[model samples]
Target: MDLHEISEKLQAGAAKAVAALVQQALDEGYPAQKILEEGLLDGMNVIGEKFKNNEIYVPEVLIAARAMNKGAEVLKPHLAAEGVKATGKVCIGTVQGDLHDIGKNLVKMMMEGKGLEVVDLGVDVAPSTYVQCAIEQNCSMICCSALLTTTMGVMADVVKAVEEAGIHDKVKIMIGGAPVTQHYCDQIGADFYAADATTAAEIAVDYCAKVANG
Candidate 1:
């Protein structure tokens, strides 16, 4: 009936309930954008905080994200009619030679949960692919994930590709994975480094907000 109820259901990971509640809210004349921001995103924000604090783990986060996605799907048509655009746009991928995708998938969900439009490039993505996608999509950030130390080097290549594409100033680069650290992020001239999916999404959202305001 109310938006808070929607948020509660999403946080509880009741996908079907969330979808029904979202539709119910829409039918009750609540604005689609308001439901998205106050209901779905609000729930996701709580999940992200819990994740950052280790109060919840990946499985819980994934479940809540699924619920949020279901709710979002129900509101898609209304969101389009209302012209409710995402807060930011980002390109996310596993860097070349890295086939790991669990982290990448988690980051994508968290980013979407934060109201950022994420373009997922799948696994083994090249530096050029990152740059090209960011440019073509008008994304403000590029997120690279690599689980292996050997693949982490490709993150630096992505930074270089962005620079060569002459979009370094227009986009921010963020890297993360088991083998990445703050030192590597700085050394490679990346804008940010996240130890996990929750942090990555939070940082990426902040960067996008700053770019939007500027």
Candidate 2:
């Protein structure tokens, strides 16, 4: 079957179909990286774009992401055997005092969709914890989500902690959530602010590429 058909199936959120097609592609001697990029990530990129355009909502995006995960699961062993590695690693969590995780979870899925390895720190994450994870994981970026205004201040603390850890130059910071703003991102000395999960993932992928190229 054509790889684009796999992409179409993935975009349609046919989890079983996508998993089967991914296995078929592997059995047909398609490179795991090619299948991941052309089939799974391609479908996710479309969903991300539609989400950014507001043509799709959370439920649809979630479904597409689920399909992508299913396909990825089937392709994982092949990918590892082929020595395929993620383009970058990122640590993500909701800031301290904020237990909201729906947005954080969505961002994680979108980042994974873009083929970035994600270290999910879960909710109620402290600034120190973020710094520690970035340092230990050698992450290229730290992403913070805060749905409450009170908890958004923790993002600034994260920036401070990264600077204090002496890795500010090496680690980029991205912030998001309902109360987050570009102005606030700048105020906290963050590298990027995304209005939504789709944009957040795109910005992260682009930033990682730029960092790698440089």
Candidate 3:
């Protein structure tokens, strides 16, 4: 299939078809980066939309994410062989006291598919934990997801802890999830609020690009 057709299949969550397109691009000497951007990222974006709309659940999303990651894996080694670096570096986690990660996982996949390197700190992450990861990774930004009303309160703590560490200004904070809203992000002093995974990746990438070029 052509690139657009392949991307359409990916949007429809066709894992096998995506994997095949990835292999095809590699065989034809197309740059791995191009395939990853046009094929994998584009496909996972579709899957993410399905997830946000409740049209698909975690299992299907995970499988689609796996397909996208599989494509990314193929390009990873080649990227390293050519010394290719990604556009952005981000640290992500589910806020403390919230065990839910389906949303966080979706954001992670979407970020990776968009060619950003991601460090996932996993679920139920404490405020200090998020702070520590940011310092250690020297990440460009922090993305926090909270699914429960109770845990969303901890996001402010995360912001404070990171600021205490003196990395708050160095990193832009973005917040999202089922229960998270723009007001919450503003209240917590986040740099941006993403309503869904696609917008998260887009905003994060564009924000960092502007930073990098500035």
**Model 2 TM-score on a 0 to 1 scale:** 0.98
lDDT against the true structure, each candidate: 0.94, 0.94, 0.80
Candidates in order, TM-scores: namely 0.98, 0.98, 0.86
Q: Give the alpha carbon lDDT tens digit for every residue of 90-137 in model 2.
A: 999999999999999999988998999999999999999999999999
Q: Give the TM-score comparing model 3 with the true structure, all chains together.
A: 0.86
Model 1: runs farther than 4 Å from truth? none
Full-model lDDT, candidate 1:
0.94
lDDT of 1 by residue, 1-214 (tens): 7799989999999999999999999999999999999999999999999998999999999999999999999999999999989999999999999899999999999999999999999999999999999999999999999999989999999999999999999998999999899999999999999998889988998899899899
Ranking by lDDT: 1, 2, 3
Residue-by-residue lDDT tens digits, candidate 3, 66-180:
7776666667787777677888888999988899988898888878767788999999888888777878887888889998888888888888888888887788888998888
RMSD of 1: 0.8
Give the poorly placed runs of model 3, Cα more than 4 Å off: 46-60
Among all windows of ten consecutive residues in candidate 3, which has the lowest summed lDDT? Answer: 1-10
